[model samples]
Target chain A: MSDDWSAEVEELRLRRRDAMALGGAEAVAKHHERGRLTIRERVTRLVDTDSFKEVGTLTGQGRYDGATLKGVTPAPYVMGLASIDGRPVAVGGEDFTIRGGSSWSGDRKKGGQGGFIEDLAASYRIPLVNLIDGSGGSVTSINKRGHSIFPGVHGFERSVELLGKVPVVSAVLGTAAGGPAGRAILSHWSVMVDGTSHVFAAGPPVVERSLGQKIGKEDLGGTQIAVDLAGTIDNRVDSEEACFAELRRFLSYMPSNVWEAPPEVACTDPVDRCDEELLSTVPKDRRKPYNMRKLIGHIVDNGSVFEIQPTYGKALITCLARMNGKVVGIVANNPMVYGGAMDVKAARKQIHFVEMCDCFHIPLIFLVDVPGFMVGRDAEAAATLRDGMRAVYVGLQATVPTYTVVIRKCYGMAGMGTTEKNGLEFKIAWPSAEWGSLPIEGGVAAAFRRELANAPDAKAREREIEAELRAMASPFRTAEAFGVEEIVDPRETRPYLCRFIDAAQARIRTSLGPKAKYGVRP
Target chain B: MAAIQVKADVAGSVWQITTKVGQKIEAGETIMIIESMKMEIPVIAEQDGTIDKFMVDEKTAISEGQVLAVLTR
Candidate 1:
């Protein structure tokens, strides 16, 4: 009986060793050199260390002969449960070594690797993190083994259905294109491994054939272009290590799913610590532009903001950050970029960011410097109002803790809520706040143009009217009407926001039905 | 040269008309203003053209994407 027990123990040990040998450090290192992380490594990094519990471990390629083979096949993608910041999460990581990390046979596998990952995240009610590093779904497998697999729009529909159920994160660690690109986009937050990768719906060859444009991958859909000009992708990084690290950081502010608030962690940046410098950060002169990004740094947890679409919609700043080590989405109107005016492109960019954060249960932080929406013929030519107002519409529908700070001017129809919608929470303002149907300078000319024209000193008269309007625009005047929430000191911003978020950390609602779905958009 | 219509992107009132009819202009040149929020948005010419027609007088209320002026290149 003792000998039988010993034999069973030895066999169990061998099985454990075989599991560990699936892809060891050497495989990880090889993928790292290729600007990618191994599936196991990515799963480990995305979730907490020693947290991931993988599924579908033995699924792989079939052999030609009846004889069995041990090292013949490897599951290219790792999927299953894990704890992110101590909360249960699901992860899908691509193993580049398996046919260079493309699910060469995912088409025949029926769900496509991306589909399986999406299903796991949805069924389990856990946030999904995709560590993509491949040349899309293996085309050779699909082209060669045609009748066995099917791919279509359903792939995208599955992801969209899973959107509001939980926070979806994507880390592009290697060349992601075609099907992989589709997977990467299903995230509220996405970051790319800079030197090692790129993403696009189609390759340059496809574009050249279809659109008659000869462009390289770097110029057309590199990380910088995607993050800056297109507003399609969210974040960009320098290496695979950074990409994995970013996945950990992004999950910090978002809950495991929409049913919960972001997990609380010990915060090193004390909430009470105030930066007095923020008081003087904005210059007294309204014409002069100052760095609003600086103000963002001062307010959130130290070095916690992972700014998305950093280059696109420069007038509006969107980022994911931690307040008291709990993830929050921060969107600020930047005076530096077109005086923080919401433009057609900016509007489109912000709406997507807002929806993403709200869907993921991240508390929203809005710094309203909106002098108004961008107006004029150029704006109209670009369908400015329609695109710009879309953000406001989306904002009104959000069921998250929204904190709006009136750093400066809030003007016109865009600023004043329409007939139906309610306003933001903690509607605080600065002392220099000013809002109206329009700026007084422009209004004065329209209302009393004859007086200005008749006066010998037209310039002087105009200046005087501007001065009076500026005075009326003060926060004290707004407070008298109870239009402003509170005139807060710049230093008090951190403490106030932190406390508000803490108190308002309620379970978020995800209204999507029991099954997955998606919407059609250009 | 024929005219091209450059429309307002956001709804607001015309703050000013920077260029008159027949003024030669280039792409991205601000020709008029629309005040929204509290700031004045300069309406720029989308293409290189000569100002052929003024769509609205100064201080006139406008909707977003409304044609503000016609330009001829």
Candidate 2:
């Protein structure tokens, strides 16, 4: 009995030692202070309630300096497989208390679990969710620049390569700066907690030393800057709890990847249930902006619009939505972002989303208010034209049943392609919808720049030009040229687009080809 | 002087002409902007060129491999 008791005491002592080594009280205190959940907490939230199968929970070191405690387990991150909503998914999260979740495998010894988890994800064809947080290769610790920088332990590049095979999703729950942020960048979809999470190539300390800018952490990688300015990330959430909710919403519709179609949900909204408000939801003026998203929500099946790359392209909003219980791709514009200006970034986003939906044989319901392409010197530097043109090429080449409804401002490239090719398919436009080579304001600026500038009465002449262009930009004007198929009442948009999707879905198998390829990003 | 094929990044129809046939242009000069999605996309010259070969005329459709122009220095 004494011998058995001693062994039990020793095991308990080692477990206590392991926890202490990973930062022990310090890490717990820090987690509480920041209102951030621990790695275990995050993993539970990601997987179905109590469905997580943790592989290496007791692997972190509890030593002060290193996990060299002979008998202690050494791991900085938790790696395992869990089923989200009953489908298997591979997930990983950093234990920040353990040396700030630094990656120091020292030649694959400490970081082998991450590799094992990735292999399971790739082999199983399940979705991979990386609740990634922390930096790579700790320089300050270890006998010689520490364990995180060792060879054969880097797991990021492989993740990027394996993106298309399986649906990869990431949520930046904390300050996921540096190498960790790159993982999130390569995902099919990524969400960031606005106040809790930040993504950047480096932290403020590095920036302060390198650029001589002592910026705050928020400035370094805030949600607004990443979501709004850079246009690199997808969505920004109000809190960590909301981030998980967004993740559930995204994973609900998508399967693993292109190999499997989005899971069908039992939708209750009537297939013919039409929202008549769409008729007047858009502004008549080509230069004015309106809420295209609201109209999309009302038309799609109840709570069915799953917008991908929502933050990347404001000019074009691409989503996988459902109508009458059938999945469809929604490509619309958020005029709030760039006056619905389709730029290079928007082009990349639109083309990728279009290609994915096409491969999956999903019908496309393109909500058009696209104000052509972005303009001026800045647009030139961005190669906006290059990207936008590629989008046009993809849209034309796509074989899915494309139904377009011209909401309000469907001028330029957006106007022509948003509808079926010269009325090749069903295209309905509202009376308020306008189509032209350019917005009258921009057209007058370019064709008669000097004339408009030199006019004796500039403002009044501008108004007159606006009126003339408004007359020229009407949907009636476009329909007269056989550009638009039929001009319908705006209130009937939901019913019209729904019928078009039904027509398109029945004809998917006949048009499958290499052109119908999958992409890792949208 | 060597020539590089200035291929369009995407397939689209050429719409606006921003350069002349015989213009001595520096690298990254706007050759012509293609119109797609109601947006004007400019095909910039990567190197200096005399616009020696204007393969695509304005309002003409060009695919990805259908060269827009060739730059010869």
Candidate 3:
């Protein structure tokens, strides 16, 4: 045999060059013309510089002239290990330039739905970032496999398990349907770029055939339907670069895995940096709604708040923020939307946010101003009461330390959910806080109905009873009786909650690991 | 020119119309105030635009997402 093995080595170099081409120049140019990034470019943009340790690069279909290989076409998916923010992550995405990034099966599966990427995240207990672009499970697969395959052969069992153990993030970078769309929903947090991305159960072709209605892809499952209306996607960004930035920001708040506590950073915003405007933030006239977002900005660590599902539930605001450098979840009621009442949508939003915070062992800060569960025929028809109660049920079951700050109105079962009744049962209030079973204005009308109906001046007598009840409903009286734990000025909210959150880290660290939730929600 | 549909954020009755048709309005300026659940919620213009038309008059009952006005930027 010849001592030189240069021929085989040269063949290997050519094969690697074919894989680097990534579906060739023309197809990649088409993808770029559509305002989307290729999988290779996306991976480069998302991960730390030169940190991608790519696996399965040599997987492709080879064309040979009697054992002398001409070239190879790479697989439609690319995946491997990478680091984000100097922390390890299993990153992968579908190569859309290759046959619209459809499923490509090699000798062994690579990633996307119960594959090596998910397995890597599970075994190593690190975060998994999925850049989903493929339209999953084409009918062409049946011709190749020579049979109509059963559903979920490459199932989501691993994806489901990863949600419980590690932080799973998905980004829909293209028009995703079927299996790919389902995978996007399995993440702890998911995002899609506006205009360039869309996700749905089926694309417009399937929808038109099933329903006999022609519709555009954007109309069916763009950010409006996916993020704002349905809340199927958690966040939407203007571009892919912004999407990547937000993904990094989201992971910064999360622990690498549930077994570890959420990472905290040093705080430059002082604990005692109380804004004087906090005192006048809530208006003296309660009917005139004030800016709750402005109020939140005044309290938390400066520039540390990241809102989740901001447009979907207009009544409630859920944010991941820092308090004295410790990561905290803020669930504040918006006074501008139905007086911050807990409607069906707001209830669903609360349940998800509360459960996520509890799972990650992040303490909660509830800035309450809810009057009660929403009222009206529309609310009743929508089963708002049931959903509202389920939110309360989930809140009661949460073991994380919750610091309730009653800013203004707190009434009924919706109000009761804000307190950490299961744990400390401690609640603090602002001097402006007022609490009761129901607001006295309406309660008096129902309780003293017949009395007021028979009075010489029913409206005047009703006002008198309301006045009497309002005097007794003062927060000071509640504090005097120890009904509430403490009453502080609005400016003291940051320092007060920060001190308690720092102290409760000891309790939070002890309870790390998967939280096994029990009982069916009401 | 782009026509923007300014929708109601809540189901409520229009309390007051703060702008007129054919008038210029800045982004973040209140176009109308809605009375809902004993609170006044302002319907704001999200972009700087000239008022195209009022979709609903003051005191009209409107549902969430009902167009309150049209603006041409």
Candidate 4:
């Protein structure tokens, strides 16, 4: 009976040490040599110091030797509740060293950690962050478990629920194929390391076996393919540290949950700060291209613009920024790309971005400079009109306060999608704005083609007609006719935006309720 | 020498050929202009190279992601 509890305590400590080793020293060394961090190291970097409280640390397949316990090595996936930037969040990721983070054979807890973290985040009403890196479902586990069973509902359902309830973020640290890749796309904000990470439905070997295609891992699902070509992920960073930093910056703009308003900070930039360069940023010549990003930089609070999907929809720019200490989403036309015309990709990008802002209670600011929807056979083949209509539908259904500034040529259906059909809080236009069913150059060619063809001097007649129509398309005419709300000086854009943000903040304070009747689609 | 393919990002009619074949060009130089939606969009080279040849003639319609030109660096 002497010191009976000492031996039991020593055994518990020894098992804990084995569980922490995580696939032994050699596997971890390989992970570090490849410029990757361990799962615990990543979690430590993501959360506040000493703030992680693990929920399932000692859960794994237990081993025994004739009734005397040998040990229980933990599962490859780790999850816990943690504080990020002083706010509570549920964080989890795969320990790739342990059998490539494969599912355990005959283990009921297989595919359980993701759902557990999702449930924890939903119940706590906190944001969820997933650091994914694995081989997805284990193919070899079927050999040991006899057979694999397909559940009626999977972790995706929980992920969808978490989307509507809180902000969900995912980071692909390494090879994330199949289910893990899907989780990366399902997130509200996602990032991948440039050289070290790859995401796809199947890795190269699988693709080669199934389709007889010889492709490398990077070629199959590299940063260029995912971020630039497909636009599946939000941003690509150079290192894991940068990925975590981006996640923190993204969460700072949104509320902890959908029920609350977005957090506001003390803005150092003056609301009345005006940049004189804005007056000339939009070229007087309609055919010339001007930088929209420079104008956005001047309008928002200094150093506050965080652009999303920058490479996907080159024509349209959608970003998050702070206006007088309040978070607002900005959607602008990039004249440098396709002359700021709305194409199929731009339409889809705008639709998804508008819905995200509306769901998260962020006010919208639209800088309009659209020539119209892309036209011709290619546009028809891409179904640009259908997607353009969807963009219009989402724009109309958005409940958040919208402020639209018409900087230049706003023509046709594409121009109409920049604001709510019924009304908006502030629908101001700059002096350079022009609006119509179509640009006179194209319209004259269509409507009065026969007239010009019949004239003695066809070229001269066409030029005269275009000049007359162009003069009448001025934005001042719309203002005098009580069509447009007001025509403001370009330098006053910041002041107008700040005024709208103040109004939106006041309105949001009165109505902090559920965002919509449905959840956001991936 | 490495061959770089320049593709059109939008569908449009070739408005003009801004560069001649075998011309030495720098990165970001306009290779050609395509007219779509009544606007002329300049297709720029992504790398410093010599224009190998034009894939589409002037006034011809081109689709998005179509290879417009080949360059050898």
Choose 1 or 3, whichever is better by DockQ: 3
Candidate 3 lDDT, A1-522, residue by residue in tens: 898989988988898898889989999999999999999899999999999999888888999999778899998889999999999999999999888888878777788887888989999999999999999888998888899988988999999988778999999999889889999999888999999999999999999999998999999999999999888999999999999999999999999999999999999999998899999988888788888999999999999999999998889999999999999999999998988999888998998899889888889999999999989999999899999999999899998899999999999999978888779977999999999898887689899999999999999999999888888889999999999999998898889888999999999889999989799887
Candidate 4, residues A1-522: lDDT per residue as tens digits?
A: 595898888887877787788878999999999999999899999889999988666777778999888877778888889998899998988889988876553323433335677888888999999998887786675777698758423557888777777998899999998788888887888899999999999999899999999999889898989887888787899999999898889989989988899999999999998899997897766777777999999999999998988878789999999999999999999887778888888998898898788878898889999989877666788899998888877887788888889988888988887785634545789999988888878788789989988999988998899999888888889899878898999999899779868976777876676666543432
Each model's TM-score, in the order given?
A: 0.75, 0.72, 0.97, 0.90
Candidate 1 local lDDT, A1-522, one digit each (tens): 354687657644554454445555577677667655566766765667787776666565544455533343555666777887677776776667666666644443323344666787888887777777666654465567564456663457767767767778787776677777877887777887565677888878889999999998888778767765676677787866677677777776666676665666789998998998888987787765567888999999998877877767777888888888878888888775557888877787788887777666677888877767776677788877877777777776666667877777777755642111332445788776778888676688888799999989988998898887777677887788887668888789899888877766543333322322243322
Stretches of model 1 off by over 4 angstroms after superposition: A1-35, A44-47, A66-71, A98-100, A104-114, A137-154, A267-270, A322-327, A376-378, A416-426, A446-460, A506-522, B1-73
C-alpha lDDT of residue A36 in model 2 = 84
lDDT of 3: 0.91
Give the DockQ of candidate 4.
0.41
Give per-residue CA lDDT, model 2, range A186-270, as digits (tens).
Answer: 6777888777788788889889899999998788788877775566578888877888888877877666655565567776887
Tell me how each candidate scores on DockQ against the true complex. Answer: 0.07, 0.02, 0.79, 0.41
lDDT of 1 at A47: 66
The candidate, 2 or 4, that scores higher on DockQ is 4
Interface RMSD, all candidates in order, equals 4.6, 7.7, 0.8, 1.8
As a whole number from 0 to 100, the lDDT of residue A439 in candidate 3 is: 83
Q: Rate the local accuracy (lDDT) of all candidates.
A: 0.72, 0.70, 0.91, 0.85
TM-score of 3: 0.97
User: Which one is best on lDDT?
Assistant: 3
Off by over 4 Å in 3: A1-6
Worst 10 residues of 3 chain A by lDDT: A105-114
